[model samples]
Target: MLPPASQFRAQQKRLDQFEALTGIKTTYSYVPYGQLLDKITTEAVGGSSEYDLFSFQDSWMASLVGYLNPLDASIAADKLDMGRYPEVFREACIVGGKTYGLPIRAHPQLLFYRKDLLGEVGAKVPASWSDMVATAGAIQNKSGISGVALDYVKGSGFQNLWLWFNCLWGHGSDLFDAAGQPRFNDAAGVAGTQAYVDVLLKDKVANPGSSQFNEYDMVNSMAQGKSAMIMVWWWTYSVLTGDRSRLKPEQVGFAPMVRFNGGKSPTLATLMPFGISKQSRHKAAAWEYLKWVSNPDLEVEIVCDKSDPQTSDIVATQTATYLNDKVNAVNHGLHRVALESLKGARILPKLTIWPEVASVLETTISEIVAVGKPVKPSLDDAAAQVARIARRSGRHRS
Candidate 1:
């Protein structure tokens, strides 16, 4: 399974060619990213006659396990040779003592900055939120563009949704505890976010269009020099810095996401995973394909190997060994520094109503920033709605 038509045809073609040469007939389906997960689940529940394996987000592992083939648990991880991939990436696939899916790819968010703009202002790259503000101001003072952009729109499924959450998360805030309580409604979380919003609406140091830009738009802005610095996942490095015609690769640089004034640098992780349907006639064959596509040789060569023209992304495994220390001499961070942030990174709050809860949070954020409501009251209402959604979702208790 893969993304819908326009974006997925190339992948389909690549797989089809591989199958024909190997004489291995395989079942594959393509759907829009928005509809893909639901279609995958529905096909699973009804029957896998039409589809075999399903692709899903990594964070949905727990949900996928209940329905999909317990692939690795059915087969030992060591037997599958987990050593070659990152350890943490392998661990993510194992749920309830069983392995579900092979990791496809992994790329953590990284900091981005423009050398020419920063040099003219003589201001250093911003790390702390306060510094981000100052840097934006300085950049604007010198360049006439907003300093920073944080997503304050509705719909948490988008990158800015996650970006906004990172702000609170980086400052030691979380949406919920393991007990699934609404901890993010606390004073610091609310107060910290208030400042976050004030920067966008009051200070206006962000792009007028940032509220609408997804992960790609931000990175593209940086490549075009519309914005000085963009905080995005590792893929941006490959995409933005690869072409000299667009922006010289040397003009861009990366660093770990910065620290808050009183906070340590946040290392954060989120997931995008895949799982098979409970209703697949081709579960075994699909698993076979997944194994091949996700094998270290393929993933590393296509994704992490910068020197290779096919190199596209970082490895999905969490282990440090998976990283290439000096691919084309890129300043790849070898440290497990992000491990702490991943540990601290908040997972989506437990709610079967996640789709709805995400919508409410996004709308509430839009109102706070777009409508100019008092940040705290808007948060209180959002927390209330989220609690209500939790009760409705039936996954969270008390």
Candidate 2:
């Protein structure tokens, strides 16, 4: 489990009820985000694990699947239909031909903008990247604030790659081809990368400090009224409208992520799923716990709960829950907006060495966006490095 222990704590509160209903006693342990991957992999390699179930990012499936119990039999036995989730979520939990886990948490990108600011400038919500730039520029000219705040800074998690990939996919380009060769240096790829960078340099509508901003910084920029718009994960709506923020709930508006004109619009999605350990002594009990925690009813309850601020979360993994009328009423229809975005969402490449590939992209984006490095040549260098990495790891097309 990652930080923001509040969500886990809330789930912990329901353990007694679960025990009463199913005679299954469960407990959860918290792990820091940075240390979790190593901890899970190390324990697995030692031929034992400290936990019966492992909660992890979807991208880690390639590395951890061998040590995980496939849930296909259990899923069929329990009559659990995986189709209830969106396509991206369903695919994220399956590797090769086996289902590994159930999605517990997921995030789709949304463009969060200031409603009052846009109204004042007579700008409608942007449906494309060009519209966003023009709208952002109009708001900036009128308000004297940066049009948008972006995360161009390098981070341990490679935050910059998250946004850049959306542009890449939007422009009909991808990080690799069907046979797993580097193609991000091709014409469409260079154009996509250039469009993303132009938000900060060419358009000049981006926050001046965006070169150093992380995801949290972009959210803070919205809370403080320093910027007019931010393209971020849907979960941030809770923080942006919470007690600490200066803006009112009515002031913030959200829409699906913008796309390149007439191109594919694929928003990046992050999914967290819990898998049963292959070495666990309590696979049945762990499956019970997984089902209970991921139940759509419980998800709707948590999203609608206003009693505890600590436990309040708007992220929903099930399509039914996102479209539920009750959930939409309380959440300002945020889940509905998220559902629209998830229609064309995409998960990261499920390669075991994605972390390394992300590192290459992070450096390339920083060099081009912050240091004014030439885009095409920098991307060419990155493609070459990635090709070498793939060849050495036996992941290349040849």
Candidate 3:
């Protein structure tokens, strides 16, 4: 599991407790995500015992799904019991006609706003793209507060590309064609890009520094009431609930994205996937490890981690974590309701290439928006580069 340091320690404590209870001995170590994935890949491909169980960001599921063995029978035959799990998360394991992972954290994106500020402005929370734009402008024009914080810092322009792409996909546009080809230059994509860009450029509804502000900035901005609203993932609820001691918890609120500019869009559910290596002689132990790590008790610890790690594991099926009292107290109006909204969320491409392709597209977003270049040509260039990446990786683009 690739959580921050505090999370690793607390989870380690729980895992240690689990081993004693189950009488199944095991050991674990922590490393950076890139280092861990690289080591595991080398071992799995080389057919060596490089690792056993793994937890990773959702994007890699499509690529690794083909390489790992199915666990449906493992659970069905009593090696583990699937019935005890939340169905939503359990299904995320089944990708490309195979069961490859479990949900360690269910990552869902949401729109966070200042309920008090909206009331002071006599404005209602936006429920559509048109409404969101208008809301942003209204807040900025009237309150001198940016309507929405740009959550794009740390290559946020890069992160925005993927989140924006999800909105595009939900709006009936595809960044790429079915054969793993890039179509970001297509009319729908161009239109989507224009609409997304308009929020920052034409509409002035978002923070001007959004291009430079990463999630940390968004956290500080929103937590301190700098921005009236922000779109962010589920786990942010932790830091968002606290402020610089001056701001009380009552300042924040959460809500599902009202709608894309087109009226409605798909809800995207991002998950951290759990997997067992094909190279493990302890396949049974690894499977048991997944079951143990993901048990409701342990999963809740991951979600509502009271630890300093802030590693809330938002498992695939557990929206209950969305209803924490502390989170609700910070922003009562939207937290739980927004959590329930996750049930209808959609998963993006599970292919391994998405990580690289997404990175390419994100890097291009700032370039396109900065130079006043049109999205179509920029996307075209992005697509070609992504295709070349796929070819070089020794796999065809999906």
Q: Point out the higher-scoring one by lDDT: 1 or 3.
A: 3
Compared with the true structure, what per-residue lDDT tens digits does model 2 show for residues 1-398? Answer: 44444556678877898999899878777888778899888878998856899888899999899999999999999999788999999999999989998998888999999999999999999988899999999999999989999998886488888889888888889999988889999999999999999989999999998888888998899888899999989888887888889999999999987777553588899998889999899988888988898888888888888788777778779999989999999998898889888877899888887888888989889888889999999999999999989998889986
Candidate 3: tens digits of C-alpha lDDT, residues 238-355: 5677545234557666777656645446666666666887767788878777777766556545545444534443333444445556544443434466555554466666667777
Compare candidates 2 and 3 on lDDT and give the better one.
2
| Separate clash counts for every candidate | 17, 0, 10
- Summarize candidate 1's per-residue lDDT along 64-170 as a digit string, tens digits: 56677777653464367766644555666666677777665455556677777778888776666677777888998788866665555555365545666666765
TM-score of each: 0.82, 0.97, 0.84
Q: Model 2, residue 244: what's the lDDT?
A: 88
**How high a TM-score does candidate 1 get?**
0.82
Model 2 error, position 140 (Å) = 0.7
The prediction achieving the highest lDDT against the true structure is 2
Per-residue lDDT, model 1, residue 372, is 77
